[model samples]
Target chain A: MGNFMEWLDRRFPATQVWNDHMAKYWTPKNFNFWYYFGVLSIVILVLQIVTGIFLTMHYKPDVTLAFASVEYIMRDVPWGWLIRYLHAIGASAFFVVIYLHMFRGLIYGSSREPRELVWLIGCVIYVALMAESFMGYLLPWGNMSYWGAQVIISLFDVIPYVGPALSEWIRGDFVVSDATLNRFFAFHVIAVPLILCVLVFLHIVALHKVGSLNPDGIEIKENKDKGGIPLDGIAFHPYYTVKDTVGVVVFFIIYLGVVFYWPEGGGVLLEKDNFTPANSLQTPPDIVPLWYFTPFYSILRASTADFLVVLGSLTAIAAIATPFIKTKRSNKIAAFVGYGVIAICLFIFDAKWWGVVMMAMAIVVMFLLPWLDKSPVKSIRYRSLPFKIAVTIFVLAFISLGYLGMHPVSALSTIQAQTCTVLYFAFFALMPFYTTWGKTKPVPERLT
Target chain B: MSSNEESSNGDSTNENRSRRRFITGLTSAAWAVSAAYAAVPLVLSMTPSARARNAGAPVEFDFSKLQAGQMVKVEWRGMPVVVLRRTPAMMAGLDEVTELLADPDSADSVQPGYAQNPARADANKNEILVMLSVCTHLGCSPVEKLAVGPDPEMGEDSKGGFFCPCHGSKFDLAGRVYKNVPANKNMVIPPYQYLDENVILIGDDEARNA
Candidate 1:
């Protein structure tokens, strides 16, 4: 086996590559529970792909047959129910892991400075995954899938002259139909998954190049031993690999629990309305997107037509003025102007378009974090008290927005959603100012 | 450097540069043409398919069996078009509720020219109301609450109309949306005309074009 490996190593850099990334690669010894999500995410991605491939064998993409075909998989094919549930639950689990992984980056400031490329790649992967999930949701040919696509696809019609035409092109028809279903299947099964895999690979490669940031915001590479390994670092294979297995086992227990007992994720992972096949003429009384998208969906619903223009102009002004406004006094003046603009726009424009803009800005604002944050320290542990409070409030706002998105729209819920939306953007927009106001603790020279 | 040597060297270099530019331009042009040709089928394939186009063809339904005040739904182009045979009282009720509607004049909404009257029905045929069943807000179907006077869902003082259960949007007998609903516009009146006394055709009301 050693002789064969040596021969293979001469032809390909198999051993060298493995040693570089795994066996000999050094990671921080102080990695905690949050760090487990990154490895768990990879495991979920593989599960989705394997289960998804098996599903495609039994699944029919044609509109008329799609609903029945899924039923067939659930009943007729032997143990096909297990595979379907695995794939369905896997999608939700992927988001769970990904959101935690991204939160880890946020709290630890893993996206700071040298790690920006890794973060950017991860963002791209996230966007691709969203597209993949959306396309996959349509394949079931259920009522929610149909109407959800209809509502989302119609969002393009707000763009003015070319809007209607562009939406028509996307649907390949006047409405969501067989054509849209077929095309979405192609994208979901092949194109997007390929892109997601490539982006994940690139993300890891970039992370490896920069090395990992620890909880204390200390660079382990700065304190290397005589053998070139960091004093506070351990080999990734023997140390972190074993640790991640424990996380994986624990995760699988919960994952299989959902698969066996609560595959629908209590009407969140899979919606109840989705059981009914799509009827284009009769829309469901209330249509809500999957849970993962509810946060942005709530924001979208909060904007009325007139408020949209105000929100748009305000967002534009803030994004543009970010570089120009250097002083705290100027930021305060801009904030006052922003409030005034919001007040005036409420009286004039509609909230419909503004809701779309806000929902989109919710995702777009995340990409600006590496630059938006001007904090002196990297980790939240060392950051000032106010910064921690701000992050906690932001998380609360996000979770609340997500919860609100799942329910029927009401006047009170709309008000609540709007307030949370404001907080969500303010967290990022005011980061440059508030981040600089606080006193940060000194980072340790090495991992404790 | 000698002038003769510099001129010869410059001439050869210019010739080589032009040759390179020519090849580059030629290759780019060929690639552009090929790409355009390749995209033609893809673009054409994206248009509405044969099944989709055929789905939009005019549909005819018999209204003879449709009783007065009864709404009959027929599918045309994959959309539900509701035809209601309004009673004399329902037709009279339309005018009384004009003050309660968002688009009382139907000026901001789409309908055939024949439906421009206060009744929003065909000229001289005010008893028959034809409109798409879809709500203008988010396309949910509005249930008929055609019972006159105070109802549980709509409110007291409600004259029978359609009330969208999804968003609480109300529409009068003439399909004009009530004010302060999530739906801003009146229900769309599809291009429709009576082919005969018993049969009605949707998607081909020539009276508007004429």
Candidate 2:
């Protein structure tokens, strides 16, 4: 056995790579429930890809046949219903895990300084996953799928000059037809999945390079022993592997419950309109996107023509001026200028274009997270009361926006959505000021 | 340090700066060339092929066998186009229901230049009403309620039109959506031309208009 081990080590760096990433890799000892989501995300990703491959075997991409083929998979193929449900439910689960994982990062300041590349790579994975889910949603060829594609594709029409032509080019015709469906299937199955896998690999590689942040947000590596082993760290293989197994078991319990009993998630995960075949002439009355996208959708819906211009100019000025505004006096002046620009834009442009800009900025703001945060401490635990309150408000605002996105648009809901949108942007934009305002707790030398 | 050594150090620093600049320029040029080369296939792939463009070709229908007050559905580019032969009563109903429509003048909606009137029908063929069956509110196909009396869904005093089962949006006999319904705009009128008195070509309006 020793001779074989030596031979294999010469052939491949199997043990060395294992020790670097898993066996001897040091993880913080203070990791809690929030840490499970990172692993859970990987599990869900694997589930989606495996079941997606299985679904491709029985699925047809043609416009006339796609709907029936999905139905056939549900009814005819042996345990095919389970596979389809797993894939469908897995899509929702992926977002659930990813959102929680991101929230964990927010609270722990995992996106700070040394780990900025990891966060950026994770964001890339997020964008790619969204594209993957979107293209996959079209494969069912349901009413919601067809119209959702139509509405989203039409959003490009808001662009000047090349808008209409660009949309036509995207659809491969004047509208969502067989060509659009075929191309989307190719992308969903082959192109996007490949990109997603590559991004996921990069995300993990970047994370390992930076090591994991703990709940205390203290650098464990700074307190290394003579042998260079971190004082507050344990081997990742034995400690975290066993701990993650428990998380996996608990996750599967809830996941299987939804997969078997409530795969539709009460019309949030899978909409009722999606049961019917795609009809180009007939559009379902309420064209709300899937649940994961509702927050941004609500923001998009809130932008009326005049309001759009105001918000657009404000967001543009703030995003552009933030990096350059160095001194406190300049920041104050910039804030005043931002307000003046908003007031000016109210009379300049219409709300329709601004709403589009607002929707885009919601995602774009996340890329600036590492810089926007100005807290002395990395974790929320050590932050002052106001910072904690701000985080709570931001989470609530996000939840409210998501809830508003799922319902029919109305005056009351629209007002709520607009408020939430403002709150959401304010959380990021005001982070530098608010995060530095409060008194911070001193971090301990070691994990308690 | 000796003056000779200092001068050589300055020369080496200059050489390093120029060398670094050269490498940066070369790398940027390589990236630009690669990006331009790669964009060719990607841009070309995005263009609509001849087959896709041809998918919207005009579909012809012979309405000679259709009876008055009857509607038949034809498939055009994977969309359902309804051609209805309106009765005299239905024709009169179109003008009567003008007050209850969201777009009575067809001002806010799209149709060919010749069909941009209250009736939303081709100027030459008023009796034969052709429109895309999609509802403007959300896109469900509204079912025809062509009777002159009350509809269970649209309430009493309801004139003949179409009713969307999904959202209860009502449309008049001329495909104009009712006021205050989920749908806010009238049904779309496809670009169409009369091939002859008895034949119509859906999706082709250029020949007669030109």
Candidate 3:
């Protein structure tokens, strides 16, 4: 104990401030990928909140001034563009990291067994983040914001009873107006952040209670000897702290680089049209969200094939509820499904070309996953690098197809657009086959 | 004893070796290239940047530079939306549009004040007709079908107005939409009561109040 005290004095004098918590603290040994991201996510949350606070100091929320004020910040204020870009990119980046982090839980079977509540809280955080970004997107008050809301609100019009009324109720008036803008501004700056912060705290508390999972899918308790030492657990300080610090530093350079430099130049980091004020009269060509949202945006815009639209919407919602999917599942199957998810993710990241090329492929891939595996390990031979790469490229082709399905050009023509849209539908409808048949990839022996 | 004292430190030595190698890699040419590229724009934005100046600067259009029927382009808030004078044929086409438009009077619709007068623009009636090239329906920019006759492919604005090639939405010379076309409103008369002989500032309105 005295030696530990001496070490604390030497290493983390800051530990002295939290004597009660730090005194009992030992490094968690079996901590895994799932653990690292929670910490990273928390750090990023703090970053987003801090940068957001600075941005709000200059942002104007009134309808008449909102667009011009953003421009004022961009043109007049020093580094205002940087602050706005950080918040914008940070919002998108936040979702990317959180999605990856959530996928980590699905990969390691963190969603099941004793940690279900932890997984649930994390899901809650995901939902809250979506709402926060939605509201924040509106605060910019650009044509994209106004029209994107116009289109999305138009979706409620398709609802059976009281649809128009519901849409109007959602907007708080006839159109996306001052009341809506002011209210969205309030929620973006204050309400959502407050809720998001609280949810993050709860997510952490839940994670800490169950400890964290490791890569091997083994429990740390299994390695413990008669001695109290966590056989698998390692001290977080100096060890993982340094490791995570490396990631944080790299991320910091990225964050700072984006914030200090060309903010909204587009094709990356900042959106170009977003630099202009919200003009209702003049619409920017090709309305789309920040890239992180394109997958679902592509899905939502795929077709008027209402059933496929419903299915696509359902699949997107399922992505959030994925944690709940494993509660009753066998572990190996859960992990295999998880891998299927990862394959889909890789395609989403790289699939840039437009048309049926990508969509036709994802359908086949998803359909094969189930039939490929009656059990997890039986699927091992399917994971050979070449086949894996084929499945990846094929699925990537399908995402590209789905993306092109959104707004095909005149040279591309209506038939071309419809064909791509049909293929997107075909992909979702045939999910069971391509996924089940792809390869009998080996799965985990059991879920944790 | 600490692990350092008890062990031969093979793992520690290996870890240190790897960390050094990693740090060494960080100083590679790739990092320099990435940093250079990122810094170029950052440096440019802080200076006399093109995007900065082009975004809100007062755009000058030389009326004399344009031939009576020829169109000249100018930037409005960095958009390539057009502004040009109405030729006599386009001006004559406006009379036919009154009965067909939703708000034929241009009442409380396209613009305010200086635009309230018929033909909705300033003196030198044939000189300037300012309108963004954008279409109100789905936001596609309408291409000018700048001709005189009602040819087959000539849209409803066949007489001469902006025609949205995307959805076939059409607007007249005064930027008024033809009835039942995809565009319901006139092309937004961006807030401008012209500045003087040839210059217009887009960000601030200089139009005379009625």
Task: Calculate DockQ per candidate and list them.
Answer: 0.33, 0.21, 0.03
- List, residue by residue over A1-448, the lDDT tens digit for candidate 3: 8888788788877556443223333444545445556667878788888988888889889888888888888788898877777777787668768766865654444554556677767776776787688778877787767755655554454444776676666666545566667877877788888998888778766766666655544446455547764665555555677778777776678766766664553444445556566654454555655555554444333332222334445556655655554345574367557556744644452111111223234333433332332222222233334334444443464456445533423323333434444454444444323443444444443322
Pairs with steric clashes in candidate 2? A282-B139, A283-B138, A283-B139, A283-B140, A304-A351, A305-A350, A305-A351, A305-A352, A306-A351
DockQ of predicted candidate 1: 0.33
Question: Could you tell me the TM-score of candidate 2?
Answer: 0.81
The list of candidate 3 runs beyond 4 A from truth reads A1-36, A106-109, A112-117, A265-269, A305-448, B1-210
Worst window of 10 by summed lDDT in candidate 1 chain A = A345-354
Scored against the native two-chain complex, candidate 3 gets a DockQ of: 0.03
lDDT value for model 3: 0.58
Model 2 per-residue lDDT tens digits across residues A154-219: 667667789779888888887788889999999999999999889889988998888999999988
lDDT of 1 by residue, A63-155 (tens): 989999999999999999999999988988999899999999999999999999999999989989999998899999999898888777767
lDDT of 2 by residue, B87-190 (tens): 98888888888887878988878787777886778767788889988766434577788888876765587778888653456799888877755455788999
| Residue A423 in model 1: lDDT | 89
Instruction: List residue ranges in candidate 1 displaced over 4 A.
Output: A305-349, B1-37, B67-69, B85-103, B117-119, B135-185, B207-210
User: What TM-score fits each model?
Assistant: 0.87, 0.81, 0.53
